[model samples]
Target: MRNRHAKDITCTILLAALAVSAATAATAQDGMGDDDGLAATDLDLSGTDLSAIDLSGTDLGGATRLKPIVVEARKFEEPIREVPFSVDALPAEEIEAARIRNTADLVGRVPNFNFADTGLSFANTLNIRGIGSSSALISPSVNYYVDGVPLPARVFDQRFMDVRSIEVLKGPQGTLFGLNSQAGAVVVATQDAVPEFGGEIGVEVGSHGERKLDASVGGAISDRVSARLSGTLYGFDGDIRNIVFDGAGNVVRDDKSVREQYSGAISAKVAAELSDGTDAVLSLRHSRSRERPTTGVWLDDPHFPRNAFAPVPETTTETTGGSLEITHDLGFATLTSLTGISHYELDLEADLLDGFIGGAQTGLPPFAFGAAGANVRRIDETSSQVSQELRLNGEIGDRGQWVAGVSGLYSDLESTTDITSLAMANGAYTGRLKKTNLAAFGEVTVPVGERLRIIGGARYTYERQQFGGTYAGRPGGAPGLAAFAESQESTFGFVTGRAGLSFDLGPELTVYGTIARGEKPGGYLFFNQFASIGIPLTEFKSSGTWSYEAGLKGSPLADWLEMSTAVFLNDTSDEQLFTFNPVAGRFDVQNADTRSYGWELTMTARPTESWHFGAAASLLHAEITSGNALIKGNDVPYAPGFTTSLFAEYRHPLEIARRAGSAFGRAEYQHVGSRQIDPANSRRLDAYNLVNLRAGWESDSFDVYGFVENVFDEGYTTSAYRAGNAAGGGGVFAGIPGSGRALGLGARVRF
Candidate 1:
């Protein structure tokens, strides 16, 4: 059945691709023949011939063309085409059109990006170019930032509100972003307070009982002060079902993976003119979010593949953060200071039914199973961090530009877990981890000639970690075994750097190449408590990557068309690998060597005044070059060999009660290739395709829209894990299924 579904999705994707290609061809043909219609209508139509105007005195260069996209991923403002790296910038209009609310929505939209769902929001993992961590104890390879403020991975599940842009920087960013960005970085810039009074309110309703309400308001409070406030409320009834029941056969549970969420944020800014040819601006922002998490289901269960037999699961998470940014402009340089703090907490309870199945087969009685022949696990965690940064930027006689900065971070984390079952009396574990980090970094770019430039950067980082934890367990009401308390401290220091060159062949074309180094510090695993029983925990070492890349970007056909392509190779030593140790019933991290290489191409075009199209494709190859025998030469888990996305939107003027309005329609399709789920390559998920369609009508103040996602209702799995690794005891397979077909309607009002 799964094979059939996969084949059907493949066929649908091919058909959609062909249709979009045909539409683009038709649009281009029409544009070629209708030159008069394409001409500016405001020009004189009073028998004015083309040769009659004097064009010699007019400067019709790039000044009238579309402006280039500016990005901050490099710690300074620069045009994307001149950065010498791969970067995807999704603007506010695109975010709103796609209804993107979280990082999970960025899968195929960004090349070489994927997310692994573990049923819990906080436990979700992000993979970029096959570099990521599956264990909760490890930090993510891809770093995330909001308005220049770094964020912890656990809090990445927050909602997007009043966002202005999202920039995804591919490849290692350690030279500027520090340790956690070995793979890449995601920068989210929210909307700031505007000088004019304006706001928008929106509401949406969708399938599976989904509902959402969002609003934003901003305006000048005084001559020198401005403020903005935004909020969102969203919820959805689950899609999965539970089939387990007692002898009476009454239904016990329904709607297994529901989500309820709410989030809000506010920002204020003050500006003043100062002496010494200087200006000052101060900005403050705060945000909070809460959500009820979702869970997965059994994949090979005898009753139903998408149904669960376990007791209902529950998860709750809360997060809050604030930041302050102050900038001062000097005559020849700019100085900036940033301070940020964040807090996160989570509580979770789940039924380990898969483990109970193995126990029941062993003739375990009801009393021996704890409650209704089942086992349970409960967990609680809290984390907090504070960070500060200071930087200075300046330019030198139009030939060179430089930026230097210093940063510091302090963080604390605590976690506790309890396991209960009739077969085992009780077991518990507690851990506390603290971390401190400091860094100084700088980058300089110099113009070699009129069309050539050289760029170099370096960072020296120091990190310290302290871990303390205890574990205790008891069996059959006997004295507990494998009980101990231990504390350990470690310090690490490293220097990472980057060098690159870029050349402009012409006003419309640029080519560049770069070589860079990235690093991740080593840390202790608090979950490895079985060492008391002589089963030593695996050792982990700091990991580092050397990346080489080349890219070309241009507007080959004019300002209406753009194209970019890049190829990169990464060699990693002491790469951290996370896997389950079934014998010890724990997760461990090991060190290995790996390699990853990929190429990506993106194209965008505006064929006519009302038509726009975009397409992106990526091809990747990742493997464990040297590792444990079980995984050596195997493909990296969750690293799809190929991925692609295509989108098109068209808008036309509409006459509604003679008001100036427009109607627009958009279609998007994404495809992901097959991938392995574990180091042993024991399980693989087939490739799948998704189709989304949207249409809307808008006036100056009011707008209405509707969308359909997963138009074909194709069944597919987003992530999977071995039962032994997830539920403790031996079983077949468990997985998280992707969402089914859904339709939604929405409206917005602007003032």
Candidate 2:
């Protein structure tokens, strides 16, 4: 690992920045106005010492000024600081300024968050607040929603287009979000068409064939209707190099494993005001990606990975979804209905050793392989989900608010797998899973006095799951060989809820405490190496978690300085975990008990109109309290103990062709603590630091920007595991490397 002194120094500097902001706010100019009662839009920036600078609009498509972050952290629009939850909300400006293009782009930007990129989109892993699983098959601990439509895991890491805002709410939210929200929730809101006609287009090209094009158009269809259409086409060429080896263990050729990558997504939304107090919106979206991806690096090298597979691996994924939302406002309350439907499919073709990836078995002659000594494997999967929710929310006598809702969801997933080699241990595999859920939930907040308030909520859920699978045994003269099939069904009922209290310390500050319970559904794994022997595919049980949290949130220095800090503890029961049972010679996903506690802080400030800076950090300790002896007391895999990010941007007013313009420069620094990758604490990846730099010249009509990602070219691992034994037979540790440094330039035009 690199020296740690730099990270410590940066952290100290970030802390100092916060302190300086506080000091500056205390003695701000008389007209600066540190009044907390002032709305965000009412903030007075006139007192700043920028009277000599020409500060019009910072830019055409972006800005450096801080805006009040509004989010649906509780499924409704509200200022972030006003919400009692531990959450981080990013407005459209922040999203674009930070260059967050997709879901995976949020990893280090948020505290206590990490991601493991597994080459394939659907197979990647995500951990938030130290609560998540390394196995992609397990039910998600966190929930993801777009425009109020819940998204399944297969399509959860979606591309962002026309996004208005994004919010990351920590801790259990089962009372309102229901299943798959044991850890937290990620909510995204896209832009809605306005009454005026407007559109924008952007293009970028960079090193390694990195290219992107995005466009959005919106207009008013009628006095009561508006519509928007947005689309993005972007991709990059191979970033990881692969070295091909011959049968004699000699390198024959070198080439990139992933190449010719391309992807595109489009979304359309139509909104109409049906009546005096009723409104409706219809949204539809589709996305597709195709690429020949690398087989993943076997060693720790970030630039080169050895492989013998001649054709590498190919994968294609597609998703289509639609949502319908209707709302009617009564005299004192509002009623809403949301219906969502989506379908996802995947096709993968790869060269493997024993149903998985590895080059060690290439020299072995007994196993069936291609002419070049590589087993051909193929997988095809499809899944569909539909959900409907009806909710009613209203205020109580101007002091309290309440919401109640009921929702139901149904999903079906099916997949088929086959190896070209018929004599392989498993000739073919097929599986199908169906799930049903019905839930009702409600929450109410009542003021106890001028300074105190009480909160309570609950959700009752009924869940049913059915799973069936078949495995075709090895072909040929093997006696008593036949395809095996099995089916199982189960049902469960549970209640989850939250209770909390909020107290106003003053007009500028507030304190809150909350306790919440959340749950995750149980299911069966689709693929296993022991399937031929009929090991029943190991059915994991459902899990639950309890969270206790306390936080302070407010605009300490009015809109100039915004901050939130929280400490939380969580206890989980029957937490699903995937482990290799060497004794049993098969993989097992059993329940385990675990504990996690952490502190999170996020802040943003603008001491002067030209300067905008922010920092986010988290300290965490998560470990297995009770589990298999091999993992007892061990840190959870891939969960970083500490993570932090600091960003500062400077914008100088510019004159371009007699139009409003600005010159912007930004610097971002991120540090991720070391992470454990296995159950026994035997494998730990080193911590790493990254810095990104961006500069641009923006005008009312056009903007051009340049950026350097991973400016330091840091060498790090994206994911790791005990590869050989975990996958097939060649037993050794392996890893996939993170991306290397890259530079790019982009241009955007808007009217």
Candidate 3:
């Protein structure tokens, strides 16, 4: 392995050298620096004096810009310091260059935000302020959105392309964004089409036989219309292998698994300046993605020694959606209306237990009777949703601004399961579900004084749900129990609100305090005949208290440094808890109370024109406050007590090689604290940290780079499955090990 890695690196360096030697005559600017046309002057902000200028009202997007401005938490468009909560904003350029594959990678670097992969290629989970569920089939306490349009919770296969920026709003955001925000919200904004003609293409290859290609184009279709198109192509041979037998009963499924993904979107924008001072814009966006198979494999096994490379059956998922939005600037503020529709299909199958069930089994009765064999379990499902929202924003007085809105949504879902029950014939079941929701909300912020501002808002929401199903257990011992379920509906309503105060302590310091109430809707679950025939399960619901607080947003010691820190307390009631009943073979939801408190600190520094450093650290304490009889005050499932990340980058002028653009190097360290699989806290995962290194040279139109992940080749487990153990597996079946130290190289070009 060592020799192979060394050869790969050597080949990469040789190729890079040849490319540089062939194209060394062009003067270039990568556009990340200042556009003043001054060589290396873009980095001059470090030593410049700012005391003489009033930078209070300057639009950072234009002056010391990053990219498109984001207003996810705060309604205003000033610096992030003005908001009274923890927030992390990363733009497209940084995301692309850093090779952040998904939302998990992005939040893994931020304080107080933990995104955990579920081992499924498409579905992911998040933990914020120690408040998130670890279950793969339940709705998340956190809310997610794209372009101001809220998405259905737990729809994990959604992909992001042509994204302009991602804003993570920490803390409860129930006032404006009700239901599903008891923890927080993530907003994704995509780039819009412009009147000018421009486009870019990027391609990369990396570790684990990974390869990716992306392209985007935007321009005007006519004088009053404009359109933009973008597409992504991705393929990778997964690191894990399946070592199971094939149809020929041959020992196959070694690291031979592969995945392919494709996604595309088209956006259209229309505008016409009216006779008045008001202008309007109508925009539409549509996107879809098809994934070959999302497979999860165990890292180790006893029965199947080579099971790590087994060939699991193939599965697929498809996602398609469209959105329409219209906005008019009426001088004082803006009036916006948005409508969206989405549809998804999932065709997945897997052997829940990694080991073979029947044929040649040693101590299994089913195997003795030839009642069961290596059969696949299938979960086939489809869902559709539609939503509409109308909002108005404007200023009330010289010191006050307000926003009011209303929204409605409807959803329908159907799921079918076909299990080749080794004891019987192909048994199947079908389930159906429908849901509707309506909400109204309003918010206002007022400047109480020159140095203080007050904010408050409220929202009222109602939701309803219905379910029906039928199991193919007919003619069996259970009898013909036709699921002629009648209409069963329930209405859930809540008023969520927020209040906060912000004070400007000094020229470079600000402090704030806030209290808010967050809420989540209730919904039913569907199951097959294997589940007990008893009373219906309780719908899940959770409510919580969010107290956010203090710290500074600007450099307190020097103009070249900026820092922010905060402390928070989250007291949650009616916490949704899920428990499995072995006798019933089903999971039920109930209400409990929990308390979580934490602190976060982050720092960004640029000491010289060639160096930049940033670091963040977080600590959390979470436990169940009530329902001791049930959970026994266990720590939350996915919440880690401590996590930290540190990163540094340096750029140097290649005087020896005369490289038009400076060469750069980066290094990062990430540490995650211990976590437990069950609320009992009986089982725990040890703490571990990972190191990564990257170095590259980029020019005006092209870039070549190399990266090494898991530099120390540390091995650790991310998540464990209970189904494997239930099936009589001796070794705990864990999925997706943190890959070992691996190296790869890639290049990109844009025009």
Candidate 4:
């Protein structure tokens, strides 16, 4: 009887695991799924573009477990449900429907991600799972990539123009993505060239005199070849104005607004079939974008003249990138190779303070020597990367499936910056920075019993960095100036890996546990002006983290609802950090041990054929564990307390003048909790919630929609930057306000 009871319990657990797996598969397949092993009838694969194909069947219970395109979880391209981690997949359709503009707009709407500071001109900084490096000058705690290519540091925070799907990989991912991806990685997939004739054009008009237009065309040039190209144009007048004046004082409100952004891409693909039931495809992509900004917004008074702010002198960014990938399928597994190259240039000219005049404004010390000129920066950056991945899969014992793969990555980057007091003027200082990295990685998976699978993976990485810069000082070396030129180069390497187990119960349930180690390489602070002080700065130090996670994913009651929950803990040693001090008027690089643990829950349900509801929430706890004397037990900067998003969409069938598409309406609510402004945990930001509503009608030929964001126009700050008052009269930091509520209308046509 005892043995029988144990067998029954084991079987029950296995069934539960299977159910979770199914839900996970379903979720991964379509970004939505239920608990049952059935699909949804409302999901018409043929009625929509195949690119929108989320799952094979409408019965979403099995959708989340399928392997997705463009990404590999564990060792295979299988669905995210099998990866044993929380993944928020944003499909191209959803992104288009939501009209997301930049990376910061993705926060709150995506799981485990948030952005605290978003002021026009103030770089959009992002935090993932309660961990982010607040300083934009340093490499981000989370890595950002476009079409499998990393964006260089100087261009990392630049706005995104043309994009398709955006995938946020939460938690440490050093094994696959490498040292800079200790916290997580974001992947942006551009729209690929379609094989069939298709095209789309869209235009949007909204408040603040905002205007945007996007267009794309794709078709097959020959039976065996295809191509696609897309472009976007956007412009907006500044909503806030600078009421302050120059020495002339003639009510000079700086028109610091922006009026330009452009992006375009083209791709071609060739396919060939082999005798051994194999296929090969070679493709290439090229894209570029540029933008000009007057200056970020700032106000001398927050009460009456709220609209007062001005664009400084001049600011601009230009980016160009391209990639080529070749893939061959040998019946059993696929071998793929990718090569990418990119270049970027940025130029800026700005009045240091918009609220305070440059002259002797408010008794503040000037950054310039003797004369106060417009602060200007000109930067040029370039990078190249090549990666190759080979995957092999085979059936094991006729009851299990197995997969293994090896990957190699090589990257090189070089950037140079020129600083001056005015646009179109001679540069005052010049600095150069460079980094190179190489990595080799492999992973394997094997099924144990009928219901269990074990997986293991490891990666070895080598990284190097070089920094050189020159700073000139006035005669006699001013009190705050240092008379020295500096340069440094360092190299380091490390290994990281992961091991995990997955158990499958019923067809609709699954349970998984995983432990992984990830690392990030540290480098010299060449531009870190404060390093010259006696801060004991190190040339190079590697930061590493270990993550522990356990989770259950499955459908609970009916086929219409599915849910996933996970608990995770992350421990780190010598974590990289950038700290800002208001009193010292300085920014410092430091290291500390830290611990982070959190719980996440995700749910998706289709109560009715036309109605869909989804929600994801995460509660996080992060604290300093040891190693830092200045900040021993303080919370990590830029980490939000909690983040959540809830969305409901309804589609209604209509004649629509005899057209076949449907009309849909969606309402979404996103919430970000209050957080500490600095590591010391002194000032606190108020929690805020936003409501967005959209209504639209779409068919194979056309789409029309309208939306309202931040419907209530609530006042909030997305981020803060410290402007140390060494003279000690004004406030230490300035908070940039989030954008106000705006409404817009849009239209899309396809041919």
Q: Could you report the Cα RMSD, in angstroms, for every candidate shown?
A: 6.2, 4.8, 7.6, 9.3
Candidate of highest TM-score = 2
Rate residue 506 of model 4 by lDDT.
52
- Number of clashes in model 4? 51
lDDT: worst 10-residue window of model 4: 44-53
Clashing pairs in 1: 368-422, 369-422, 370-422
Clashes of each: 3, 1, 12, 51
Q: Write the per-residue lDDT of candidate 1 for residues 362-382, one digit (tens) a residue.
A: 444212322443567777888
- Looking at model 3, which ten-residue stretch has the lowest summed lDDT? 47-56
**Cα lDDT, model 1, residue 524:** 74
Q: Estimate each model's TM-score.
A: 0.88, 0.91, 0.83, 0.82
Which candidate achieves the best lDDT against the true structure? Answer: 2
Better of 1 and 3 by TM-score: 1
**1-751, model 4: which lDDT tens digit per residue?**
4533543453354345445544654455465445544444433211111112232224333332222333443334554555556566667766765666776677766656766543423245565665666556556668777666666554565445547677777777776666477778877767765577888888989887777787777777665556776666666664544343444445544443432344444444444443355544454444444444323333233341232223334545555666555556665656555556666555554444544323223454222212334344445545555555555555556334454455555555544444443322233334456666777776666778777888777888887777766544432222323434567788888998878888875555678898988887887654545322323234636778888889876654444556778898888887766675445655666677778888888766554445555677888887877644667798876666688776666677776887898889887767777777666554566777777789989888888999998776666666654444424365444566666788999998889
lDDT of each: 0.72, 0.76, 0.62, 0.60
- Give one digit per residue, the lDDT tens place, for model 2 in 1-751: 2435654565576567657654664345333344523334544332121101122222211222343445567776554555666877666767888998876578767788668777677877776777876688777888789998899886687678899877777888899998688888888889987778999999999878999999999999999999999999988887766555555556566665455589999999999999999999999999999887654555532324444455568889999999999999987789999999999999989866421134343334311232352457788999999999999998866557789999999999888887654345637788888899999999988888787878899999999999888888665422323678888898989999999988877665678999999988787887655566666776788888989999988665554666778899999898888777767866678688889999988766665666677788889999989977888899988888888888877788898778888999988888889998865666788988887889999987799999998876787877777665432444455666677788999999997
For 443-558, candidate 3 gives per-residue lDDT tens digits of: 88888777787888898988787767665543332333333333356677888888887777765556778888887765655544342142344556645555555545544544
> What TM-score does structure 2 among the candidates reach?
0.91
